[model samples]
Target: MNTLLFCIQNETDAMTALVEVLGQEQTALTQAPSLPLMEEINAVMQRKNQLIASISQLGHTRKNELTRLGFKHPETSMPEWLQDQAQVECWAKLMKLTRKAKELNRVNGLLITKHLIRNQSTLQVLYQNHGSTSTPSLYGANGQSNTQRSTVRGFIAI
Candidate 1:
């Protein structure tokens, strides 16, 4: 019981950390896109991944402890098994944190998708302009003869 509570607390802590990282991700995603901001977001994502893994491991440990406590199917039976007030409160807090983290993650994912769509639209426009012979080439020297003109059409299929 004590071990299970400890595992729950650890998982809760990890989830809390993950929520904070997700908040950072949300902030980064909402800001103007830049190389440095992208790097920071990447770092935050890595930390978030680590926290998720840690939480998963702690959850497994909590399940094992529950099994040792004689709950056959701990996943479904945990609610019924948590009779003590402290354990119940801790489990409730953990669940609340989990939901908060999940919501933050969902919002961040939407923001990323929004950014991706915007980037893809920009790329499509650039591709169209690059392929059009009528549009003046943005690349190449103004006066010098160039053997090959770099084209973005090849790079972006869409």
Candidate 2:
């Protein structure tokens, strides 16, 4: 029981760290790119990886504890085994943190996709302006072919 408590507390702490890193990642993705911000993002990524590893270890420990307590499928549900109020509360907190982390991660993924599309558009414009045949070929949105050629002959600098 003590081991279970320790694992729960460690998992909760790791989840908290992951949430902080994910929040920082979102901020970095939304804002303009900068040296310092990029540095911070890299640092956050490393921290996030470490926290994830710790969480996984704690989860394994938790599974073992549950199994030792005669749970046939420890991974299925820990709440059913938990009788202590404090342990149940800790489980609730861990679940909430997990949900928050998932939400933030999803948002960050969308932000990254938006940034990629924006950068690709910018590159396409720049390539067209340069009037170079060596410019990257792009596939049509209809997904038919990449052979579609642009008809615009004049370059307009913005």
- True lDDT of residue 77, candidate 1: 76
Best lDDT goes to which candidate?
2
How far out, in Å, is residue 80 in model 2? 2.7
Candidate with top TM-score is 1
Model 2's lDDT to the true fold? 0.83
34-110: candidate 1 lDDT, tens digit per residue: 99999999999899889888888888888888888899998987787787899898889899999999899889889
Instruction: Check candidate 1 and list the clashing pairs.
Output: none
- How does candidate 2 fare on TM-score? 0.78
**Lowest-scoring 10 consecutive residues by lDDT in candidate 2?**
149-158
Q: Rate the local accuracy (lDDT) of all candidates.
A: 0.82, 0.83
